[model samples]
Target chain A: MSSQPGTVRVPQEERTRAMRARLLEATVECLVERGFSGTSTTLVSERAGVSRGAQLHHFPTKNALVVAAVEHLTEVRGAELEKAAAALPTGRRRTRAVLQMLADHFTSPVFTAALELWVAARTDETLLAAVAPLEQRVGRQTHRLTVELLGADESRPGVRELVQATLDLVRGLGLANTITDDARRRRRILDQWAVALDDALADDDLQGETA
Target chain B: MSSQPGTVRVPQEERTRAMRARLLEATVECLVERGFSGTSTTLVSERAGVSRGAQLHHFPTKNALVVAAVEHLTEVRGAELEKAAAALPTGRRRTRAVLQMLADHFTSPVFTAALELWVAARTDETLLAAVAPLEQRVGRQTHRLTVELLGADESRPGVRELVQATLDLVRGLGLANTITDDARRRRRILDQWAVALDDALADDDLQGETA
Candidate 1:
């Protein structure tokens, strides 16, 4: 009998990585479904179908587990956004497409889970300490990605502000969708913003030409 | 000394109203200071400086108390908004003033309390049923007021959507403020939005002239 590299014996490191992924995924699911208050280590372990010992070994506390899970999910979602950005259409329709892609990202399950943590963190000092820096990093990355996707020139007088407004608008739409299916209204709002954004950018181009 | 209307004797109805207002204000303070999960009836009563008996008599359950408190505060805040709208500059600066007022409203304590409820209600069926309608009414009122303040013609193409986007943007700004002050960033975003809004409205006027 001989053991092969691709045989039944999974590498210890690979097994540990897989287990942690499952736990993190389960934590996000719990956060989205039950919110922060309802999520617990035991529940996450049960949902992940991992032993309590394994869960503790991976994440010693609920705070650590949740923070890590959200960070992991945010990284995964950011990668997805980058991939989606590659598939976006070019030319006149690109502005609307970019806004739509952003709207989709904000309204996804990971965003919902993050919203729960954000609200919970508001009054939880320890959680706030952990979550605030994570949110700032995510915010900066999202802003940078948006600027790149839109080919926005921050050198323009109002272009930078316009980009920030776009992010805030999509985030607000995401919050609106949490209580109700605001998709129709969100679509209309994004359509309007797309035109405004294009006009602002066009004005910036005019300024650039004159300069 | 016969009892006089303005004298030492406060009417039973007046006293009851005052007590309830105190309790409701206290609840908002609690919700803002201590997230939804941290807020409790006992804490609310203690903060309000009202007897437990009176608190229980007024609001039998936590859900009922929080719902009523938020509703009460929203009405007060809405009235305040209406009052503030009356004093808005009626010239070139009106749009910026209107956006600023809205930004203030969304970032206020009452809105913070509503946000806590909104997040908690995501996973809470009973709270959802109670909050959804209240939020809808508030949202509609905010939109209507924005339209009126801007003198926006809904019949014009994209006018209504632009207004809705304004609300959503301000709300998103509010969400950002929850994590940190975000005031400087918010001001720049609102200023950018103000210019975009003016351009859209001006375009609508141009179309009106053509028609």
Candidate 2:
């Protein structure tokens, strides 16, 4: 609700949340069809069937709208990871589940647009501030998953590095092949993950080697 | 040179090559500034100070100009790799050199533009064909370097996996980082590579029980 006493009769939390969700969804659609630079609040509002005034009420500026869209997509990504982690038995199953979840997310507009926006964010300071934490969060989940799946030897030479590397590989593949050959792209991703996981778990005392 | 003996004088082969090279450099400049959808053949010709007819003589279509640019970049990348490779002693030294060469190539506008073009290629079939083989060449080089550096143990357990994962990581970083913090990025990359390389060389054949 607005802090102003009588700004609106029903600036209720539910209404605001619903409007934000609609705008965010519309942003994803516009981003997918027209890219980050091409997407605009006008198009997003039109697609969401919200008046331009209504859209502005929720997001005062285009940058704000873009940031919110990125944040929303990041949350979707986090939720997907959580769902996958929840379904797994424990340990390596959880790791594999996360990988599968990543592959699935790449197929969705949320992941694709979020990534393109992340790339754009590198040039846009405001957007970068919003996306950096998302990356850190994903990195933390990956590192945690690696530790659980690989057990005590997770500290071994190649384990952590392997985690970072494999994560990047899937993300790169998703960016490189998002527009075509979905099945082939997914298989390539799974293959890369399966190999990286097996390698990390098998090595011991490797962490000290590089030092 | 034109084939007909009695025809009007055609441009010399060397002149044509020089003109083509100039246009390609300009195209790369345009690509770096405008991206795939924004770059234009006329802009490239103007940048090169060549007439449109001269530009068309070398590259008849917009796609052809891009394909030529990609080809020229690939050649430059290959030469850089060879030069870097030549500086190393043997074995792992050479592989490390290869890695440095890769880092260097990525910093070049030509290679960076090619990467941007690779993403664009996902939606453009002709561009995809032009870019696919370039990736294969890089992959093949990686495979060779891994074989030479790690020897017969590549298929054993996790070796191939670790190498692939590292490749993925570097590629992703190359695409995502904008401010070009090469020193820090390079250190992170080397740290991971060293870990993977050491583990691959380690003689342990069985899964360790614990840390």
Best by DockQ: 1
Candidate 1 wrongly placed segments (more than 4 Å): A1-10, A204-211, B1-10, B205-211
lDDT of 2 by residue, A106-154 (tens): 5567767776665566546776777677666755765576455435354
- Could you tell me which 10 consecutive residues in candidate 1 chain A have the lowest summed lDDT? A202-211
lDDT comparing candidate 2 with the true structure: 0.65
Error of 1 at B82 (Å): 1.0
TM-score against truth, every candidate: 0.93, 0.76
Local distance difference test, each candidate: 0.91, 0.65
What is the per-residue lDDT of model 1 for residues B1-211, given as tens digits with 9 covering 90 to 100? 4656556456767899999999999999999999899999999999999999999998998989999989999899999999999999998899999999999999999889999999999999999999999999989999999999999988877888889989999999999999899999898888778877888777744222345
Residue A167 lDDT in candidate 1: 96
DockQ of each: 0.62, 0.31
> How much is B100 displaced in model 2, in angstroms?
3.6
Error of 2 at B153 (Å): 6.9
Fnat of every candidate, listed in order:
0.75, 0.27
Q: What is the TM-score of chain A in candidate 1?
A: 0.92
Estimate the lDDT of model 1. Answer: 0.91
